[model samples]
Target: MIAIRLRSSCGAALVGVLALATSGCGLSAELDRETNPERKPTPSETRAVLPPVSATPSPSVSVQPVSGCPSSGLRFEVGRVDGAMGLRAMTLSMTNCGEQPYELNGYPSVSVLDEAGAPIPGVRTAEGTDEVPVAPPGSAPEPFTLKPGETARAGLLWRMAAEDGTYLRVAPDKKRDFVNVRPEEPLDIGPENILGTTPWAPAS
Candidate 1:
């Protein structure tokens, strides 16, 4: 009876040991699953982020007529402007829109004006093409007559200055009333403040 009891106790202890070992292995596996998960496959394509587009419009030159003909019956317009090496050349034209012939003997009086039509101060006006050599040299003023529907042209030259003008106050001569003419582009005058003009000549 003593040998049989001893064997039975040993059998029970062996079974308890086996249960503990199995439980320990299950707990270890659960812990590993919690700590480290399975990895997923990587995708071949990725999305990209981009910046927002702007809504403001860029500035452009105006093509509409800015002024009407003065009582002098001559219409003045600012023509093409050419720039090179900091020098600017502009063409000024006057059309005889009246019924009779118009007399133009000399260089037209020109002054840079602000948006308010007021002359910009400190700008010097030269009557010949000597100071600014961008345009063709002008001949001395001689009395000339423009028939109706004819046009006369003058060359204006200047270095880039510090001031910008919106309008040009032009007169056929110093004695006539000034007419405002708008250029396609604003005049960008620098610190030089000097404007040179050639004498009125027949447009070829």
Candidate 2:
């Protein structure tokens, strides 16, 4: 009876030990699965997007008219300005280096134009009502006359409404031929040719 009881006790102890070992293996596997889970991308994966670049436009150049009287004859040159008001108020001048007297008629005409070459506002002369006539070299000088070896200067104050390109035309009177005047300076009446060849001053 004693031998039978001891064998029974040993059998119970072996069953308990196997049960404990099986439970410990199951807990270790569960812990490994909980600690290392499968990975997946989140919804905020937008770091690869890029922004676009923009380009700038080139600037346009403004042109004015100019005419000069050299000793031999008339020489013509064109001037180009970049600012806004250079087209509005201006001073037109001419140098007379000939032995005879020279006469200039009609005020310089101002015209404001759009990109299509159509006149933006209207074309007009910017001068006062005073008549400027020609006389002898030493006599009183005015806008229309330049004594021999004398320099004649005139002022033009123009009011304009322009968006882009505006220009001035310094033309001689249709009746008066600049070639007939002494030292025969070239006559310029085109757009974009009026500023430098002829010395100028700002309207005061």
Candidate 3:
């Protein structure tokens, strides 16, 4: 009877140990799934979670001339002056902003003016020639037409002078109305009092 009871007790303890070992394996597998879930994201799910991105704006294009277009449909501007030794040169540019084509065949008519807008006396204006080069040699003026948005340029040459000029009165040609343009720097046409101008040519 004593030997039978000892065998039964041993048998019951072995069953309990086997059940605990099986349950421990299932618990370890559950913990692994919770700690490290799979990382596969669907395309729709990704789009829904991310914020929408805005597009960058493009730069604007400039169509108007440097100076505003005027009622005459032309814009006139003086380029920066270039000086060496005593010779001073600058570019005179005109842009056609009108619908009609503008004609040009000769040098622009220009005169220096005082602060009161009166023409300064004793200033000699002449056409530029090879003998008296205004700017580096460029193609001579020929009859040309500038359509809308086209530009023409001319060279102005002078030397520092005794009388300082506050403004320049310019006409596209002798026939057109004069337009007043203030030079970037005041004009100091020296004692020679000469201002030479090249004929209108297309801007290269």
Candidate 4:
């Protein structure tokens, strides 16, 4: 009876040990699932977008400056200026030097002078006559450029009392300094005293 009791007690203790071992293995499996899980995908980088470009080109231009033309750049010559029956005829022509173009407008100041440096009569004159009206009348004169190798033509007509002056003087319009002039023919200053022109114009 004593031997049987010892055997029964041994069997109960062995069963208890097996149960404890099975519980420990299940706890270890739960801890491994909590510590290490499947990895998630890495985040991707964001990119910037740009605006579209146009196909057409922009336009550009250059401008030139304007300047005044003076007397020293011109040459003066004289010829016949009249086509009418009643007036003495002469034309004053100006040529610009090859150096540069000169701006000219209106009529030149003209005078006939004696050798003694006195103003001669019959050469005293006005700007217009009944035979030929002043061109571009009653307005500010437009400036015309006398280019290099180009000429500007003006008319000088008068009715004269005598051919008394030894020198003919010419100046660009309103300019005070005078250049001496020689007519194509010896001027015959008759008895008429009026002097005028058709005004100055660009030579064709």
Positional deviation of 199 in candidate 2, in angstroms?
A: 17
Top lDDT prediction, candidate number: 1
Error of 1 at 142 (Å): 2.4
State the lDDT of candidate 2 residue by residue for 76-126, as single tens digits: 222222112222223345455566765564443334343333443434332
Residue range 1-204, candidate 3, lDDT tens digits: 212332344455567877888999999878767865773443554445664432211123111233567778988888665554455666788889878899899998888776566677877778763434333443456999988999988777776666467667787888998777776566767444778888898876
Worst 10-residue stretch by lDDT in candidate 3?
Answer: 54-63
**lDDT, candidates in the order shown:** 0.70, 0.36, 0.68, 0.55
Ordered from best to worst TM-score, the candidate numbers read: 1, 3, 4, 2
Q: Candidate 3 at residue 179, lDDT?
A: 78
Clashing pairs in 3: 160-190, 161-188, 161-189, 161-190
**Pairs in steric clash, model 4:** 159-192, 160-190, 160-192
Candidate 2 clash pair list: 64-192, 64-193, 64-194, 65-193, 65-194, 65-195, 66-193, 66-194, 74-185, 74-186
- Per-residue lDDT value at 93 in model 3: 86
lDDT of model 3 at residue 82?
Answer: 57
Error of 2 at 84 (Å): 12
**Which candidate ranks first by TM-score, i.e. highest?**
1
Clashes of each: 6, 10, 4, 3
On lDDT, who's better, 2 or 4? 4
Between 1 and 2, whose TM-score is larger?
A: 1
TM-score of each: 0.63, 0.32, 0.62, 0.52
